[model samples]
Target: MRELRIRAGYETLGELHRASGVTVATLSRIESGVQIPSPKTLNRLAPFLKVSVEDLLAAAGYLPEKEEDPNEAAARTIEAAISDDPELLEFWQELVKRDDLQLLFKQVKPLTPKSIKKIIKVIKAIEDAEATED
Candidate 1:
């Protein structure tokens, strides 16, 4: 966790606190191995660190380490990416409901954020075109 925080460019707990809104004391305790972060804390920190909450949970021993399903992982990735945008979240919700696009989620797991945004934009365009046709 310390390594990840440093790699994410937070040189000090104060810096992380400013960016993530997690208190420096909590960050210090977690990094010093004196405390394990709760799931809510992990959720609050994961986006700033560019990691998944599940990865943090597994590392903190809350979850057993194992291979994750690609589709499920991709869904989590997409959900995280769109979490701050209501319109994108709605589009994502709609996309996941379509059986024909289920395989697309598996393929998206390894994509960069820019690529994911492009895919979502394409999906939105397709949906708009279909709506126009109807």
Candidate 2:
């Protein structure tokens, strides 16, 4: 927390107190490891330090460290692609809600715009085939 405070340019507890409204004494205690910051305290400090409360909690040993899941990371990439094209957003939003298509979406994270359109067509064709089979 102290490193975060310093990295954010808060040189002293007084500076942090002025910006975060947390008392200097409490900030000092937290930084010196004399006290574990409560969730409320972490919430107050996180914004001033430009970090999430979860990060502060993890640093303070309150929460387990987070690891990014590959599928979720891939989904974020796909979502970024969808957001960049308004035309894609509507269709992509619906497609992304399908659990069966999740692995396909992950595999296509690096697709070009043309490739995305091709994939969309293939997906539509598959859906049509499945409907006829039903």
Candidate 3:
């Protein structure tokens, strides 16, 4: 953990304090794994440390991975990417549902040259649509 923090160029505890608004003592405790931080503190440290809370916890051996199916893994990956924020999760769930992306993502088969060209065309159409907006 110390190595990761250093490699991320945290420089000093003061740097973490300045960025995370967590006190030196608190940051030290977390780094040492002598204490646990609340979600808010964890969130603040995540970006600056260039690490995920889950990864940190895993490093500390406080968390374990659970087996999941491919679709479940993808959904969890999406949720994890958004930090599981309720609003973002709802938005993502709704966005995928509205566009029916979940079903499509599941049904996508091995890509061939023809299919790749079709995908490029679809992406170009979406980009053109967005580019038309002011």
Can you give the TM-score per candidate against the true fold? 0.49, 0.50, 0.41
- For candidate 3, report its TM-score: 0.41
lDDT of 1 at 133: 100
Candidate rank order under lDDT: 1, 2, 3
lDDT of 2 at 30: 86
Candidate with the greatest lDDT versus the true structure: 1
lDDT of 2 by residue, 1-134 (tens): 77899999999999999999999999889888899989999998889899999888998889998988877776665566556666566666677789897677556547775565666656767876998999
lDDT, candidates in the order shown: 0.86, 0.79, 0.66
Q: Which consecutive 10 residues in model 1 have the weakest lDDT in total?
A: 104-113
6-82 in candidate 3: lDDT tens per residue?
Answer: 88888888876887788999888877879877766766777878988886655555678544566665555555555
Candidate number with the higher lDDT (2 or 3)? 2
- What local lDDT does model 1 show for residue 64? 88
Error of 1 at 1 (Å): 14
Q: Rate residue 31 of model 1 by lDDT.
A: 92
